[model samples]
Target: MSAIDDLADQLARDALDAAARLGDDRLIDDISKAIGASSPVSQEAFVSAVRIRQALARGRAVMDSRLTQAASQKAGPEKSGG
Candidate 1:
């Protein structure tokens, strides 16, 4: 695999490890809350190779939302000339 492919594979495994260490139930809860899913997605349904990939995607969304909010808050004072 190319370097980029290798990195992608590594990240997927890392996410799977994180999910497993945290437990499927907990990861599902956090992921649901983060993604605002209408219904809970079953952790058991995830394949080993895909668990981390899915979790990372969901987690990244939450992180992006929080970071955007923080940046907006920080910019508010500047925008107001404060």
Candidate 2:
């Protein structure tokens, strides 16, 4: 990747990590806005990377949830004393 592309990717990753740590999901958007104001050239790439990562995270969560539910079902229901 070119320098700008590499930088954008790193910024996207760092922004996501920061957001997770700070418990503010808007951090990505805030970073994107800052980049747009200062370095418009890399803003698109950064935002794209952020979106791709978020989508991947969501997909993984869905897969994990489905597998967990399936396993619980296969294990059968719990029993209780009368």
Candidate 3:
């Protein structure tokens, strides 16, 4: 990857972390706007990285919830002895 791509990914990751840490996802959009102002190319790459990462995070959460629920389910009664 080019230096800009790496930098964009890093910036996107940091934005995600900060937004989550502050409990304000809107920060992602706000940061994106700022990035666009400085460098549209970087902003595009950064937005794409942010979106892909965000989707991954959501997918993981969904699968994790299902796995936890499945694991915690109670087993049915055993067959009775004759």
Top of the candidates by TM-score? 3
Give every collision pair in model 2. Answer: none
lDDT of each: 0.57, 0.90, 0.89
TM-score to true structure, per model = 0.38, 0.77, 0.79
- Write candidate 2's Cα lDDT for 1-82 as tens digits: 8988888889888999999999998888888898899878889999988888889999999999999999999899778798
Per-residue lDDT of candidate 3, residues 20-46 (tens digit): 899997998998899899899988999
* Superposition error at 45 for model 3 (Å): 0.6
- Give me the displacement of residue 34 in model 2, in angstroms: 1.8
Task: Using TM-score, rank the candidates from best to worst.
Answer: 3, 2, 1
**What does the lDDT read for residue 79 in candidate 2?**
85
User: For candidate 1, lDDT tens digit of each residue in 7-64?
Assistant: 4466446555677787764654464354334423322223333655777779999999
How much is the lDDT of residue 8 in candidate 2?
Answer: 87
Off by over 4 Å in 3: 74-82
User: Lowest-lDDT window of 10 residues in candidate 3?
Assistant: 70-79
The TM-score between candidate 2 and the true structure equals 0.77
